[model samples]
Target: MLEVRCLLRSVRFCSSAPFPRHKPSAKLSVRDALGAQNTSGERIKVQGWIRSVRSQKEVLFLHVNDGSSLESLQIVADSSLDSRELTFGSSVEIQGQLVKSPSKRQNVELKAEKIKIIGNCDAKAFPIKYKERHPLEYLRQYPHFRCRTNVLGSILRIRSEATAAIHSFFKDSGFVHIHTPIITSNDSEGAGELFQLEPSGKLKVPEENFFNVPAFLTVSGQLHLEVMSGAFTQVFTFGPTFRAENSQSRRHLAEFYMVEAEISFVNSLQDLMQVIEELFKATAMMVLSNCPEDVELCHKFIAPGQKVISFVDKAQYICCLIISYTEAVEILKQASQNFTFTPEWGVNLQTEHEKYLVKHCGNIPVFIINYPLAIKPFYMRDNEDGPQHTVAAVDLLVPGVGELFGGGLREERYHFLEERLARSGLTEVYQWYLDLRRFGSVPHGGFGMGFERYLQCILGVDNIKDVIPFPRFPHSCLL
Candidate 1:
């Protein structure tokens, strides 16, 4: 359902046939055929699966859908064309006359002249039946066929538009897209929750360890993007990240996509926060404009009476709330809501704390900055503030989702990085990273946004698996 057109943008197809041939009839997409204004019936060909079919004494009606659009094209034909192969979930090539529809529901409909059954589907065996709104859990069982549903079709199109919008945002902002490596030697997160790779049925000494040293699926693209930040002033990478945590929480995923960016010459957290705020606003607005109808359909079926887009628009209008992590802890302590974990000055913020902070900040996205140094990773820039020590880190928490983005000013000082890595026993391992600080290192910072969480936040989807196709989690990996 996600066309992934950007992947093919650089590929140019050249067909130089020696002899010219007659042009075939124009084949139109469901979106195209629906938007036609031709009152003077023009012949058009549409190929897609049948969404619904109705047989009457003298007339027949069918709704055909292709992934191009969320709405299906209404087809009206004579009852004489009705056949057993014309059941729901069957693939067909429909040649029809496109004419303006008298119904207010849509602008145009098709009057079928010829119906060719390309593939016949047995309705009884098909998991997805006609006119039944299956819950997301049920649809998830049929991972291979769930995309055919209008709900998933809408979600994927939104995802595609969002991906395109994010790419455009970086391009317009003078940020180079870097394709970071999927396998890395270093654990950027320092969490030790990594998926290590080893060859199957291995025995030889050299082949025992594939890379001689263990390799892991990358947990973050921040380190790789930082390398590019040295050359390119602004660089970004949007790709899959892996974590070996066994959490079955709605937010946790074994494999997911991340949108990470690094900016050079950032003197303060204010500069980094500005970029994060703008990225969210710009991407949201662009996706809304690109796929409004598809988004609306998701709001209708998924959230049911929830104004997902309006809430996103409201967040854009109001300024994102900014507060120190100390302020956040104080706010949590003062609140009446009982938290599962106590909110202390140095402890990490739990989901409950994050949600409460967002609500307390007038229901807008809130940025909590300057986390405790001991709790944060080694890469964060040290505050060097005596008495109460912290790092120049920031986390953006939204209403429904906790910690939408996490970033900080990277430790650009050579001595600080060396000492930290030495303490962690990784000095020789990260010689290349140390080399960056040795020569002309600028004060740079970056943040990574969870792509799936962003989709769930915008679409009001309850589960992370619903938004992404072939979701990889602790115990779930469906084809």
Candidate 2:
């Protein structure tokens, strides 16, 4: 009788269990709604900050943006639903129905049925004033709030697209993606511009140091990519590189991203040059095709009143011209204009010299190859020219931005590399680097392109700081 009573109680408890509730679907992004067709009469939810608001006696019109696209969605709300807090920079959520718009700027509009304020923002205290065009330099002072501006929003979108295009270019070419270390013992450039790592709040002895001897933030990932090239025929790395230089120029940054690639079994410098040309052209074409509106916005910001051209259009007229370093020197000598730094055989090319060379070639991209050996690093291959003394190094100089890309064939001969390293006082530290050539080294080459510099070139942005999200320089590291 007791067992029968317990069974009845269990059956009653099972019958009283609650059923599972289904979750609501996710909200549609502004970009999705802009591209969608036949969304009329459909109820949708959108959450974003107010870019602009107009309150009228009969109705209220709000321009809302969610950073998904360059254009904003027009929302029409009843006058009764409008509140004083629905000003610029205020965050809110709206439930509305999509309908055909009578305005010419957009094809569709949202008729708000419910409006809820998530966060209220005071218009008088906001740093970004409405309807005011702020200079890029002024915007630099407010990095935290500058992204809400239209100019920065467009630049960031283009930057993101360019990054994706780079990855696609490498993946389609059968290249493997590699991640090199940020903390390394050797400076790849051998320029002695490394940021050394030390313990916090105390001076530790050499034996008690973090890396025991000395570790530094890597100036370049070229050396690590070279190590990976031994196993993978083609490999690349894209990440932040650091430098301790004290330059406060628009071109210099304390930390920046570098896109480096290494290829094995290359025959000559021309093969590597071909890779560089195709990579630039392919990436440019992708960005121009994918983000036309964003690119246009950037051009408008940089060069107002100038007609903006499609990347494909500009690329069609531009051809990659290759000139020997000797020929380039001769050309500079014959130029009618005076240069700040005279174009000598052994001296590295300055920014003015590079821009002049591009202009001399009818404002096109030019690859200046076979630079003097003394001006380059120890890893560059030595050209067999007797008196000229040049190495198989190259720099791709575009019209606006000088020296956009630099690369060369690496020294693969074991004895030659060892001798070069010994002269540079890095033989002991890079004995492992020498081992690659000692065991089995094939002909290889690669190049490094500054990521921010590339965006500045493509988008016509004058300053490198404007292209990057966060600008880092000497005495100026702000949020």
Candidate 3:
């Protein structure tokens, strides 16, 4: 039971009443009041964009979707009526009684007696259609309009539900919602490449004294959030986090949303991974239960659409489960035929290895913990006994996507923190972060899970661009 209050921030909604309305009986989404006992005599109004309009010999069926469910309402309108006037992308409201029909196995459907077109999309101009098969790459190009399609619409909705579930899980578990600044002066992650904004309308060169000092877009919010954790006890921030990495891989994005949470008085890396695991379990259950329609939509469109023709009806395409990096490598050694990249200890798992591990070895999400320090960021706590260069970090990977999450227990000692920063050549800039340790910082750990990546995983969408209504990638920037 998901209750969503439509606070349309980025979406543009039609105002000033697109059409005359009859008495508004509490409007219900297709999934919500669909199969209720009161559905027999219930007079309800439902509004959504038309998914498809089909006319039979004497009856017309307009499959309408509100981004609520993959199963569209089979609106049985009279053939004498004008359904040709309706079009895709048209916002409509239908008032009717809910009834079970034998034509389909659907539990419930709207027996529409009155249909009103609030807004109509021109069929010729609308890029999406019921019959045509569009490429995923082509759909990525049109991020904003992609959601109008049933598959993309369900993806966006599932993404929304997952996002809400994250906040709910944390909020319920005593995590304070902290709003970390987007424009910051520090690159705490020590990732060299970043986007820097200047006052003079040019890329600020550090040597030229632009803006007097170089200030780049923030790569991570962990360091600043650490400062807040001392007072808040448990704090988390969810917002757009930027990284200027120029990698054009399908996994990396220039700008994305991160859910960064830091807790005070934590002891070890084990504590951090436990929290991450719980978060993953809660989120997965929420999606599986609440977003059943969206999940089915993913099965129909993204998985079985064309590329996944063989495993359309199969019980499993890619297996999902939790495993360590060492375990992942061991599993990879046995399943050589399925993967192109061979996984090895101390080496970062490629997207292909992640896909194979989940597809064949593990039938669920995999958590690869205790990564090599040389590969991990400078702030991760080091493991001196096992390997000097290895650190205590964990990355959550799924079948369709790689590196959905990256988090670890932060190095708490002042000297070790200073040593790592100095070795990485970031000492001068990160002195303030070390000051947190000097004053009253306790052993703390946190992780950053990109909101878009979670969205892609939940919806089973291949590309991150489709999940976000307005995506800011390396190439495209449009509202």
TM-score of each: 0.93, 0.93, 0.79
Writing each residue's lDDT as its tens digit, candidate 2 over 179-267 gives 99999988889789889998776676655877777889999999999999999999998999998999987677999999999999997
Q: How do the residues 146-248 of candidate 1 rate in per-residue lDDT, one tens digit apiece?
A: 9999999999999999999999999999999999999889899889999987666545455357787889999999999999998999999999999999998
- Relative to the true structure, candidate 1 reaches a TM of 0.93
TM-score of 3: 0.79
Q: Lowest lDDT 10-mer window, candidate 1?
A: 10-19
Candidate number of the best lDDT: 1
Each model's lDDT comes to 0.89, 0.87, 0.74
Model 2's TM-score against the true structure:
0.93
Evaluated against the true structure, the overall lDDT of model 3 is 0.74
Clashing pairs in 3: 318-359, 319-358, 319-359, 319-363, 320-363, 320-364, 320-365, 321-364, 321-365, 373-390
User: Which parts of model 2 are misplaced by more than 4 Å?
Assistant: 1-26, 202-207, 305-312
Residue 348 local lDDT, model 1: 92
